[model samples]
Target chain A: MEYPAFLPAGDCALSVEFGDAIHPEINARIRALREALERKPIRGVREYVPTFRSLLVLYEPCVLGFDRLVKKLQARMAGLRGVAEGKRRVYVIPVCYNGEDLDFVAAHARITREEVVRLHCAPDYLIYMLGFLPGFAYLGGLDAKLHTPRLQNPRTKIPAGAVGIGGEQTGIYPLDSPGGWRLIGRTPVRPYDASRAQPILYAAGDFIRFAPIAMVEYADLERRQAAGETIWEVREA
Target chain B: MSSGVDRTLRIQSPGMLTTAQDAGRVGWMASGFSRSGAMDLPSLRRANLLVGNDKDMAALEMTMTGVACIFGCDCVFSLTGADMCAALNGQPIPRYTALQARAGDTLACGGARVGMRGYLAVAGGFDLPAVLGSCSTGLKFGLGGFAGRKLRAGDALPLRCPEIPVSRLSERVLPVPNALDAHWRAQRPGMQLRVVLGPQAAHFTAAGVEAFLSSWYVVTPASDRMGMKLEGKKIEAVCGYDVISDGVAPGSVQVPASGQPIVMMADCQTTGGYAKIATVAGVALPLLAQAKPGDKICFAAIDVREAQRLARREAAQLRRMEIW
Candidate 1:
């Protein structure tokens, strides 16, 4: 509801709110703040977790006080420029719309399965944040027609690479976890690999677009991934 | 904690939930990795220091129950936190003290004697690779720890063997009194954790906030390292329960539509969409971590500055004890 409200997440952290809703402008502002902090490291701030509309800044209580840290952050915000207005990285992920809930989503939306798949792969979804699981990107900007409620009875274990929709959100499960999201498809490429030097595939403030593939193509991509090939493509524009 | 190993700990019977943990995995929260680490950090440090290892070295974090492990080499070890009635080779060993375990010695650890979790630290620390910069187990994503899972039977943990035998070197005893220490004594009359209400305090009605502070809650059976579900007075919300998804820290008390509060723990997700009412102070985490299921809990509102002061005091106390 408000912009720039410094609230205590705990004694050691502060959640700096930019706005109440998930909007591109608010997310851009958070990304700007994060970039500024990274460029010029804060004295006591350890890490910054940028979410839909807030930046959770974690610091050591023994090193700095809450009020003093807020004051320092205020000064930084006052002089902040449009850093996030520049180039936004994009991730092209391939998915096969052969998930178990494909027919269910189509029936609920009162559209054909092809139409549902078309709507799902239409937009370049904005990765608002990564949470719940490691490298599990929380993407925004799903088609209104495909906005379906989660399963009444959540599934016990949704496998990794399953593209899912829950409420007004959509994302990919990087790991197998018990979740309530409606799965529409599955991706062979992993958003997260613990053994990788980078570990995570993408970051917050990036754009993710789904590329539809046939069942045979999915098998090919899966085989490539298994053979140590980078399936996902990253384009900087 | 240092590289190079000479000994190994072979698990004969894996307890209820036992895993290796260190301080935690940091600098990766933005990527959605949970800060999974030792629940009772103070006890972890004490146990590690007692065994002549670095304070934050990877140690066995036994929850509720203990493991039946066998030493593959002669080494020194120590146990802390909730006593699990541990015995080396059929002889009972004391908590918070270093002991000598001969090669092939069978160390059996029973259920918790007091608190809900315990820590076992060996002399040279376990020779586990640091996944994502920490040895802590991230159970959610199945990363870190021994093959990214809890301790199970047939898992042999490679560890560094102590260079000197017990007969050659001086005995390693902690400087602090081994009696029911100050920390445990203060938490005897049930758990009363301090809270700093905010971040989403505006989302809740004043009466709802009042109910939360004035009520006593019970930890439900459905609880784990991720979060503790507390059932008590229903904390009402204003319009709706859902908030725009945001980052959540450990100890965040998130209240959903059901009016129940789920206090995030050491292994909770990095972000959550539920509206958080308050966060328990860092100083109270050790006590909260030790709280067992069915334990009564009360909340006391404390200013953020005061909570920070208490945290500083605890850190100072630990540092003072570390000198010995």
Candidate 2:
């Protein structure tokens, strides 16, 4: 693979662009560079924000100049071997397909509610990156049949753990906030819990599979989650 | 008040949107958190310095309107940023100067006369617990700073009381003009912000880039802590406005499909899908923060090296003020 172009984001930050579009290989390369930087930490590197096709790095100008920082990154990239593919964690999240917009999504897709649930559960969606809101994972690999447009008028508040789809992507809302996605199901497990050692549950390379559950099971899982019990079953992907 | 325990401030009223802010929350962007801090960072640092607090110490960030609070114990405090016509016991207090307050004394602040946000820093900084390595409030995520929300009436904020006598230090320290205050005053009538042409500068037409540099953009009422939306000449794009979502930094000038620019601020989202035409230089962020609705701002494109030089110069100036 060709080395990514290092573009100046601003005086304080720089972007290492992997490609123009989002692809699994491009994302893996981005994550590889991030992991490399983490292992051999660069001086004055403050933040590393990984996206679909690039990694935005913020640094203090006082400690490290932009040119020098880019040189260090380039040197690291030269030593990086084939994409560092670690064992990706697959989380089994329990979801109840009884969302307020489930019927709307079914009608829009020209399928029954049962079909909607099946299509959603079939794929182990890849976690692209986390953004928009805290713990909100941008998942790719949604079934082409489930591709639906966002709401014309977004709802004011989407509850936490609400599974929704917008365009080619489907994600879980980690917090109650105004969103434009079409909600088709609700998950019992919290994607974000501040009290946890690691606040966010999943990383960029992880995979998530939705396990359809009944209303009774959803209520039981919700109760267990509130009591600080692990709800999602995790295993090596 | 107890003799040895920490001092505190009882909020009588929180005007507009008052939240505890510091330098910023760093190293958390990967977890989808923005570095939410004071919009006018220079002012916050100056206010903290005046009260002999750490430069990045937590302070009250008052927006549009100021706050009204009563001192639970004796302390020295300073007000900086927007001159909100602050008063101590009905008598007006001067901006950028530290004043001693006794227990039960009320500090009332009125609406800003010039800038949008104001800073109130106490002697030893607020005793707020740092969440995720920062006390700066991230209101969207509802984390950090005084219960991770805006300061409301009846909220009591604990202060780190000085072990030594602060009275002597307060008297010895004279009010001096800080470099930040001087730089802010120097750019009075002309609101020109220096920006660096972007990582996606080629996405716009030459005419669009020219329009952005030459035309004036008015600050719209839709502006807030998240971003400042501007209404001005349309910046036509050559290859449309959408981009694969990417990580956004503060002061990014993102132009959407509508052609209008939105300057991201302190509490902006971690990632955005709009194409960024330019990024406002770090040194000019304070100036942009002070701009209110209807204010007209012109952009001047500077090279990345020049932006770094300006940032370094500002840092040097701030360091020089330590001796004064």
Q: Write the per-residue lDDT of candidate 1 for residues B1-324, one digit (tens) a residue.
A: 333333689999989999999989889999988888998888899888777777898999999999999988778888898879999889998887888887889999999877888899888789889988999988876778899999999899998655445554225666443222554566655567899997798889998999899888998889899999999999999988899889999999999899889999989989998999999998787777887888878899999999999889878877876664
Q: Estimate each model's TM-score.
A: 0.92, 0.94
The prediction achieving the highest DockQ against the true structure is 1
- Clash pairs detected, candidate 2: none
TM-score of chain A as modeled in candidate 2: 0.95
Candidate 2 chain A: 10-residue stretch with minimal lDDT: A80-89
Query: Each prediction's Cα lDDT score?
Result: 0.87, 0.87
The collision pairs in model 1 are none
DockQ of each: 0.83, 0.76
What TM-score does chain B alone reach in each candidate, compared with the true chain B? 0.92, 0.94
Model 2, which residues run further than 4 Å from truth?
A: A1-3, A107-112, B1-6, B171-189, B321-324
Model 2, position A63, has a per-residue lDDT of: 74
Docking class of 2: medium
Over B1-324, each residue of candidate 2 has an lDDT whose tens digit, in order, gives 457543789999999999999999998888788899999998888888777777899999999999999998889998988889999999998888878998889999999886888999998889999988899999987899999999999999999875446765464233433334454467654488999899788889999999999999999999999999999999999989999999999989999999999999999998999999999989888888888898788899998888888888878877865653
Per-residue lDDT tens digits of candidate 2, residues A1-237? Answer: 244888777798988998888888888888888888888799899989899999999988777778899899999888876485567789999999998888888898899999999999998888878898988898989988888999999999999999999988898999998999999889978888888877889887788999999999999998998888899999894
Interface RMSD of each: 0.7, 0.8
